[model samples]
Target: MDMIAHNDSLQLYASDLYHYPSLKQPLAGLKSTKINLLFGHDEPNKKGVEDWTFSSDHRIFHEKKIPYIYFGVEDHKDYHKSTDTFQNINKSFYIDAVRLIIEAIKAYDSYLPIDSKD
Candidate 1:
């Protein structure tokens, strides 16, 4: 499950973020947060993980044992291609996703030092 904040300021975003019909969206399948931190480099974590960390910026931090949160949609038809332009982005969905990330950060901040197992 997601660990986003449940406060008043973030409450209004529930509809667009959580209630949105992601199942019907081409960029659906919000990946699990914890699983990524655990199995990021392990053969592209597919089972319960949200998405693979193929070539993400998180690799360095993960290698350093610093846990990080990833908020991203699944690959689209234009992923990593020249056609992956801003014009192709669904603005409304992008905005909602950012909002959800903000809320999640607020919630995650409460936990602070998300330490490593070692």
Candidate 2:
């Protein structure tokens, strides 16, 4: 988290190999963007496989209370396999997922350097 802030990042949104078709869950930090609402809400499933708490990088942010979000999709047949090639990706879903992240960044940029009272 500090490293991201040191590098001048407004917020961090980590996108894995796949993203959900309609839901982009915010795994940690401030839920201050419309993307947070569009993707439902900031829900951290500490014990779940997709849980950001389990990710070493994300865990640092979570522990430090820094802003972060995680985007991912349910496991597919090709997950973690040789068959998981670029050509097998869901292009449309991936595109939308990227767009959503862009939108989130744009929205947050306008109100960045967030001042937290915590």
Candidate 3:
């Protein structure tokens, strides 16, 4: 109960501080789901995007041609070692990353068919 309350409080604070629009679907709904395989762009220097090392059920996904879009930055010197703060974030680069993902999703959804084999 205390954890739930804390999470709710944090969610409320995030919404208030950032004007975060409430998502209709819960996070639980996204787990184990195949997201659309939208186009991805990495910077020329390969700053934000890199090969994901975590093991995934990709072979199964690929056998069925499941699509997914991965976004976010690579682990660098500033990653989670007390140096990765809001101030260190690149604003323009972040914006471009977001825009590219948004466009990719739009284009992918428009062109691709929903996977009927579950």
Judging by TM-score, tell me the better candidate of 2 and 3: 2
Q: Across residues 1-118, which tens digit of lDDT does each residue of candidate 1 receive?
A: 1122111122212211221233123222334232221112233434764433324665565567554544444445666677666666655455555655555556555545667875
Worst 10 residues of 3 by lDDT: 8-17
Top-lDDT structure, candidate number: 2
lDDT, candidates in the order shown = 0.40, 0.43, 0.34
TM-score of each: 0.52, 0.50, 0.42
- Model 2 earns a TM-score of 0.50
Q: Tens digits of per-residue lDDT for model 2 on 1-118?
A: 1211111112234543122322232323334442222232233532444443444555565567554555444446666677676666655445545565566566556545666875
Give the local distance difference test score of model 3.
0.34
What candidate 3 gets wrong by more than 4 Å, as runs, is 1-66, 114-118
How many clashes does each candidate structure show, in the order listed? Answer: 1, 0, 0
Residue 98's lDDT within candidate 2 is 57
